[model samples]
Target: MSRKILRATYAPQPQGQLTMSEHRAAVKAVCVFPAGVYWGQSYGPRIVSGSNDGSLLIWDPETGVTNRIGQHEDLVNSVCIMPGARDRAPRIVSANRYHSVRVWCERTEGDWEWELVGQHKHFVLSVCVLPAADGEAPRIVSGTWDNKVLVWIKQLDGVWKSELVGIHEEDVRSVCVLPAAGSEAPRIVSASNDKTVRAWREQTEGVWESELVGIHEEDVHSVCVLLAAGSEAPRIISASNDKTVRAWRERGDDGWESELVGQHENLVRSVCVLPGAGGEAPRIVSGHDDHTVRVWRERGEDGWESELAGQHEHWINGVCVLPGAGGGVPRIVSGSEDKTVRVWREEAEGGWETGLARKHEDVVLSVCVLPAVGDGAPWIVSGHGDHSVRVWRERSESGWESMLVGQHEDVVSSVCVLPAADGEVPRIVSGTWDNKVLVWIKQLDRVWKSELVGIHEEDVRSVCVLPAAGSEAPRIVSASDEGMVLVWRAQSEGVWKSEVAGEHASRVSSVCVLPAVGDGAPRIISASNDETVRAWRERGDDGWESELVGQHESWVRSVCVLPGAGGEAPRIVSGSLDKTVRVWCEEQRKGWEEQICLQLDSSVSSLASYEHYILIAQGNQTVRVWLPDEDPEGQHMLWIKVPASPCDAIWNIDPQAGKLRKPEIIVGTSRGLATFTIEELPF
Candidate 1:
C-alpha cells in the first residue's frame, strides 16, 4: 500500500510528532549537532536518533528532511556524536542492546556507512565520545549491563582496542566524559543501577581510578557534566528512578554534595546540560517516564523554576539540546516511546512549540465519530481502502490511538455506528465493494465479531443506521450501485431480515436515515446518479415506496436531512456534480420545494449537517461550513484547506453526553483521516 504523511497543528497543545505505523516503535536515543559537522550539506542544526525498530535516522528540523542512514540488529540504547576537527568527517557512535557499539560516518561520495567498533559481553546501555589530546587518538567510553565500563581507543594502525575502565557492583546505566581542563587528565562520570554515581579519572597512560561521587535513593539512570566556566568546577547532574534529578557540586574541603534540581511524577529517564551563555546558570533538561520534557532554569532566590518544554504521547526516553547557530535560539530534540523524534523550538515570547508529522499506509475511504459511549472520550471509526476498519480512541496523555477492529474481503465503502437494540450492544455497520453489508459488535469476551447481514446485486456504496422509533428494533439501510436500496430489520434472536425499500433509474450514490418526526415511521433518504433525491417510507400492508424529493442539474452525489429551524418542517440537503447545493423544505401545497440554492467553485463530494451548520466537502481540496439560516451570503462561512481531496466528513457530536462542548470534524480523504475542532465559529 502507498504511504501518506499528514501534519495537524490546529489544537493548542503541541504540534504532533513524526508518526509511523500504529504499532509504533520506541525511540531510545537522540542527539543533535551542527549540520555541516557530519553531512556534506549545511542545513542548520541536524538531529540523529536511534529507535527500537532498529532504524537510525538523520533529520533536518528546519527543512523537515529525513534520511534513514542505517539499521541495527536490535534496539539502540544510546547515541553520541564523535568529537573531531572541522576538516574531518564526524562519526556517530551508537550502542545497542545487543552487546555492540557501531560508528556511522559519511563516505567520500556523500553516502553513509557504519561499522562495528566495540563489543561487550552484555548489552551496552550508554556510550560517549572522549576528545583526543595532542598526538593521541580519540577514545569512546561505554557502560554495560555486565557491571563494567569499557574504553575503546583507536591504535596507530586505525584498529580500535577495548580495555576495562572500572567495575560497578550493579549494571552501569549511563556514562559521559567531562570537558578536559588545562593539563588535567580526562574525567568520566557513570551512573549505575545500584544507585551510586562514580567518577573515574585517567591516572597515567591508560590506567584509570574510580571514586564514589554521590548516591540516590533509587537507580541512577543517566548522568552528564556541565561545562566549567571561570573559576567554578564543572557540576555533575544525574537522573534517577527515584523521580528526581540532582546536581552534585564539589566542596572545598568536604566531599561532594547534591542538590535537587527538579522532580518528576515518574522516573526521570535521561538528563542533559545546556551550558549557559556569559555568566548565566546552565539550564538542565530532563526526560521522564511521564511523557514530558522539562527545562529547569535557576531563578535566583526562588531556587530553580522549570517550564514544560514538550510532551509525547508516551514515555520520553532521551533528550538533547542543539546549540544556537548564528544567534538563533537553541532547539530541543526529544526521543519518545511513541517512535518519534520531535523538534521543539523556543517561541519569541518564551516557551516552546512543536510541529505535527504523521504517516498512514492506506487511503481512508470513510470516517465517522461514534456517539460518546460513556464519560470517557468518544470513539472514532474509519474505513480504509485496504479492506480494514479501525477504531480510534484518545489517549489520556495526548494523541489518538488506533486499533484494527475488522477486516473485509474487499474495500470498505462506508461505515456508520448503530444504536443498541434493547439489551444488545451497539454495533458498527459497514458496506463493502464485495456487495456485502457486515455488522460488527463487541462480543461478551470484549473481542469484536462481524456477521454478514445483507447482500446486494452490485457493490454496496453506502450504509446508515435507521433511527429507532419507540420500541421498534434497530434497523439499517444500505444503498447499492445496482440502483437498489435495502432495509435490514432486526428480528428475534438477533437475526436480521432484508427487504428492498427503493429503486432508482440509475445507480444509487448515497443513503441517509432521517430522524423520526413525531410518532411517524422511520424514513430513508437516497441520492442517485439519476439526478434526483428520493425519500422512502413504509405504507403499512402496501410495503415500502419512494417519492421524488428534489432534482439537480447533474447527478446527485450526496444527501442529508436537516431538522427544521426551531419547530418548522424538516429540510433535505443535496449536493450535485453541477457545483451547487440546494435545500429542500416541505411546503403545505407545493410538497418538497427548493428553498435555498448556493453556487460553488467546485463539485461537492459529500454533505453532512448538525443543527443549522452544513458541512460540505468539495472536489477543490476544501471543506466548508455554511450557516444557511443565519448568514445566507456566506459571510460567516468557515473554510478549511486539506492536503488531499476530501471524500467524506461528519460532525463528531454527542448530545446525549450532556453539556455542550466544541465539536470536531472528522474528514476522510483520498490520502488519510484528518480531525480538528470547530471551535467558536461565528454563528
Candidate 2:
C-alpha cells in the first residue's frame, strides 16, 4: 500500500526520431539533486552542481537564475567543468548511475544540450576534466563502480577517443584531474571502494600509465588536487567512509606521503580545493553525512585547523568554491539531501555565514490546479524508477507527502483512475511487471489498501475502463504480453466476475473500451502483435462477438475509439509499427473503410482521442495532435515532444465534478510521465 514516487522532471526528446546522442542532448532538465559542485574553468559567474536527479544546475548568484543542463535516466553522481581554453566549446562532463558519461554544451541561443560520449560497465561515479592546450583536445577521466578508470579524448574530427587507464578489483568511486603544472603529463587521480587511490598519467596520445598513491581503510568517495605555493609537486586530497579527509604529498617517482587533514562524525562524501593566494596554504572543504561542511586550513606546517563552514538538515553530499568572477572574494557552495542548495560567504567581520538557501530539488510533472485533492488544491502524482508512485499534495503548490497507495513490484506499466458511479470516490488501478492487476481503494480511516487480481500470465502491459455498459460500475479491460485480454466487471449482486479473451495470437499490447451507444452494451477494442485490431461485443443471444476490425503489414500496438455520436458505431483508429495510422469505420454497418495513410516517418507507438483531436505518438518521441475535419493545407495542429517516446497517453479534457481542474493532456513513456494544460483549444 505504501507507494514510492520520484519527483524528478524530464523534458521531451525532439519529435525527429533522434539518435542516441541527440536524444540525450535535447533534455531541458534532468532531476539531479545537485550533490557535486564544480567551481571554475567554466564560463564567468557560474557555479554548476550535480545531483542524483540526473541533471546539472548552473546557478548565477548575480542574476538569481538557475539553468539546468543535461539529462540522464538514472542517478547523476559527479560533474566537472572542462577548462574554457577550447574555442569551439566551453563544456561540462558528468557521470551517472547509468554507467555512462556525457558532455554538455551551450548554443548561441543560450540553450543547453548533451551528448552521450562514453561510459563504463557499472555506475559512473565520478568525472574530471583536464584543459586543452597546444590546439589539442581536453582529457575527460571517469571512475566507475565497474572497477575501471577510463580516459576520454576528442579528435579534431569531433570523434571521441578513449582508453582504459587502469583496473581495480573494487569500485572506482571518484576521479580528479591534477593541475597541469606538476605532472609529466596531465595526471588523473581516482578514489576507489577498494580502499585505494590510483594516479594515471598520459604517456602519449591514447596511452597512459598508473601508480598507487595511498590506501584508505574504508571506501574512498571523492578526490581533488591542490598546487603547492612554491613547488611543482601536487598534493592530492580525498574524503572517505573512514570519516576523514587525508592529503597525500608526492615523494619520489611513485612514493607518496599521507597526512590527516580533518575528521568528521560521519562518512565524508565530497571534497574540493579552494584556490590559495598570497601566503596561505590552499584550503580544503569537505561535506559529509553528518550534515556539516568543514574547512581545513594549515595552522603550522604539519598541524591543521578545522572550522564549521555550514550546516544542513540532511547529509551534505557535495561542496565547491566559486571564484569572484569580477565581484568579490571566493564563496563556498554545498548541496544536500534536504532539498536545498546553499552557499557559505565570509562576512566583513571575518566570520563565515551559510544562509544562501535555495531549493533545487527534482522536477515536477505538473497537474492542473484542482479542487478535489491536495487540500482543496491540485495534486501532482509521479512515478519513479524505484517502482513507486507518489502524490504531491497542494499545500503550497509544491507540497507533497508519501502515503499508502497500490504499488508495482517493477516499473508501473499503466495507471488508470476509474471514474466512480453515483458521485462515489474514484479508485486507482495499476498494471505491472508482476503480471497482476492491482486496485487501490481508500478506506474510512483515510488509508489506502491494495487488492491484487492475478489476471495476466506475463507482464500486464495496458489497461482501460469502459463507460457503464448494462451495469452501474465501469468495466475494466486489461491487455498483457501473455497474449490474452481480460475483462473485469461487477455483477448486479455486488460480486465481481472476470472473463478471458484469448483471440490474440501474440501479445496484446493496448486496449480501449467503446462508450455506451443507444442502450447497446459498450464494446472492448484491443490491438495486438498479431498484426490485427479486434473488437469484442457481448451478444445477448450468445457469449461474445469478435470481429477483426483493422489489418496492417506489421504489429498493431495502439488503438483508440473516437467518442461516438449518440450511440453510433465506434470509429476505431489504430497505429502500428508500420510507420502509419489507419482508421477503420463501418460504412452502413457492412464494411470498414480505410483512409490514406498518414506519414509518421517512424513506428507509431500510441494513440488517444479527445474533443475533436486525435493524438498520434510516433517513435520520434513526439505527440502530434491532429484534427480530423480541419485543414489549412494538411498538418497536425500541435506537436509536443518529450524526453522519451510516449508509450501511452490520455486526455482529461472533461471537467470533473466539484470544480476540479483537469489536466488537458497526460503523456506517458516507459520511464517518465508528463502533463500539461490547454484550457482553450484553437478549434
Candidate 3:
C-alpha cells in the first residue's frame, strides 16, 4: 500500500502537561541541508548566519556542518543575538534590506524559527540586541534608512513591541547598545549618513533624549561599544565613509572628545570591539572597502596600531568578533560583497588562520487531525500560545514523532482541517491573535506549506473551511473579535480573495462549517460574544446572509455542527459563558429552534461534535461528553478532569489506529494537549 508523506516547515512542541519552566528544556538544535551565509553572530559553540540567499544557517565549528533553518524575503542585512531572560535560550534578531526585522526564538521541541516583529518605513540598515540584565526583559535597537531608530522591548505577555526612540537628520546606518552600568537605563548610540554620531539616553521611562557624540567629514557607517573595565569608562567607536575610525569618550565637562583610532585607505564600513583576553589590551576590528579587515590594538601611550588581519575578494560590509569558549583565541567573521563570510582565527603559534567561516501555549490554542494514510496512523496538528503550529503522528516502531509546522506573530487562536475526500490531500487553516488567517496545504511534492490567506480588523477568534459547493472551490471562513466574519476563496495557488460574510453585535467567537443536507448550498455556523448562534448561507443575488438560531444569557463562546444521521436534519451546537450547551435543529414549518439545553456548573470554553457526542470543554478543567439524543432527556455520558483549564477541544480519528479503533477527543488546555477515548462509554 502507498502512504502519504507530510512535510512541513515551522515551530512545534509536544503533547503533555509541562510546566512553564520545564518547557524551556525542550528546545534542541535540529539539522538540515546546508546553505550559504551572510550576516552572522556567535552563540555558544555554534555560529548563526542570515544569508543573502534569504536563508538562515547554523554552522557547527567542530564538524564544519552547516544547516539552513529559516528564510526571509530579502537579503539579511544585520543579525544579532538578544540576551534572553535568565536561564532561557537567547533570541536572535535579524534585518533585511526590506522594512522587515524578525525575532527568532529557539522553540521548545522544535527548530529555531522567526516571527516578524518590527517594520520601518524604509530599509532596516542595522539591528542591535540590547544588554539585558538578569531577569530584565529582552530589548532591541534598530536603525533604519527612514532616518529613525526604534527600540523593541519584550512585554510581560511575551510580545515584542516597538517604540520610536529617536530620529536622525539623515539615514541611520548603524546602532549599538552600551553595556549596562549598575542600574542605569539603556543607552543607545547610532551612526548616520548625516556624518554625525549621536547617543540616546532613556531619561524617562519610554522617553529618550539624544546628544551629539562626534562628527566626521563623511557619513558615519558603523558603531560599536566597548564595555567599561576597572577605571576605564565605556567608549563609543564609529567608522566613517571618509576612511576614518574614531573612538569617542565623554569628557568631565559633559562634552565628548574623539581620538583618532585609525585612518584607512578606503571607507571603513564596519567596526566591532574584541575584548582583551588574559590581561591583553582590547582590540578593534574594522572592515573596509579596501578589501581588507584590519585589527587595531590600543598601545597604551603609543596610540593605536593597525595591521591587516585578512583580505576578502571584495569590499566588506559587516564584521563581528566571535569570542572563543574556554579562553580560545577570538575569531573575526566578516561578510563581504564576495558572497562569503570568512573567519580569521589566531593559530597556536601566533599567526592568523584564515578560512571560510562555515556557517553557521501554554495553550494548545487549537487541535486538528489528518486521517491516517494506508497503514499509517492519523496525524494531530495543534496551535499554541507560544506562537507555533505543530504536527504529530504515531509510528509503529518509534511511537510518535512531531514536526513544527507553522508560526504566527501572535497567539494562535483557532485551527480547522479543510474538507477533503478520502485519498485527497488534507489542508489546515489557522487563525491567530495577530488578526491573520493562514492556510496550510500539502503540495504535489508532499511538502506542506502555509500561506497567509486573509486578515481581520481585530484578533481572529475562530476559523473554519467551507467545502466546495458544486463548481465553487472550498472557502475559508473566519470570525474576529471585531464582530466581522470573512469568507476567503482561493484566487490561485497561494493567493486568496476575501469578502465580508456577516457581522455580530459583539465579537464573533467561534465559526464552523455545516455539512450540506443534500444538493443544497453550503452553510456556516457562528457563535459570538453577542450571546447568539447564527447560521449563514449564500443567497445568490443577496450574497451571504445570517439568521439567528440559538441564544444564551451570556457570550456564546464556541460552536460546532453535528452531521445529520438517519433522516434527521443537521444540528447546530453552541456552548456559552452562561454555563450551558444548547442544541438547535431545523423544524418542518418553523425555522431553526433550540431542541436541547444542558446546564453545567461552570462556563463553557469550547465545543466539538462528532457522531452523536458533543465534547464540551470548560475553563474549570473539565471536558464533559454529552449525548443530546441518547435518551428521552439529554444526559451526560462522561466527565474527564484535566490538569489545566481547557481552551479548545476537537474530536479526531484514533491516532493509534487499533484493531477495534474508535474516534477520540483531544483537549487543548492552558498548558498542553490531552487526548481521551470514549469507545467504551455505556449506552
Predicted candidate 2 versus true structure: per-residue lDDT over 1-683, tens digit per residue: 21112232433321211001111111211112222223323444566666654556565444333444544666678777775564455677778888888987654222355777785778887787766668776788887787988878777778787788888889988888776663355688889999998888778766778888999889998888877777557799999999989989988865999999887789998888876644556899888898888888887776788888778777877777867545456777777775456667766676687533432222221111212433354344443323454554433344334343545666465666666654455666677656877776667787767776555778687777777644466777888977888877766433457787546888787888766556567778899988998888877547678888878887787888765555556688888876678777767666667754565656777787765467777655566777665632236356665554455665643335432245356665533445545544445
Off by over 4 Å in 2: 1-77, 81-98, 102-123, 154-161, 182-184, 228-233, 251-255, 275-282, 300-302, 310-317, 321-416, 428-464, 475-609, 614-680
TM-score of each: 0.52, 0.61, 0.48
Error of 1 at 410 (Å): 20
Residue 298 in model 2: shift from native, Å?
3.4
Model 1: residues with Cα > 4 Å off, grouped in runs: 1-23, 37-40, 108-110, 277-279, 355-683
Q: Residue 197 of model 1: what lDDT?
A: 96
Top TM-score prediction, candidate number? 2
* Reference-based lDDT, residue 76, model 1: 88
What is candidate 1's lDDT per residue for 1-683, written digit by digit as tens? Answer: 21122334221111223432211268899998565533344556678888885767766565443445566767989999985655786788999988999998765222356778878999999999887877566889999999999899887777789988999999999999877667776688899999999989888776899888999999999999876567888888999999999989877568688888887789999999866654567799999998998999977678778999888889989999877777666767888897667777777797788732343334467877666654555677888766788888776576677777889977788998888744455688999878999999888887899988979998788999887666786688999988999989877655789888989988788998766566677688999889999989888778898778999987798999777766776788999877788998767677778888888777788998888889999766678888887866666678887655577888877635532245567787655677756555556
In model 1, the number of clashes is 0
- List candidate 3 segments past 4 Å from native: 1-44, 108-110, 132-134, 355-683
Stretch of 10 with least lDDT, candidate 1: 7-16
lDDT of 2: 0.66
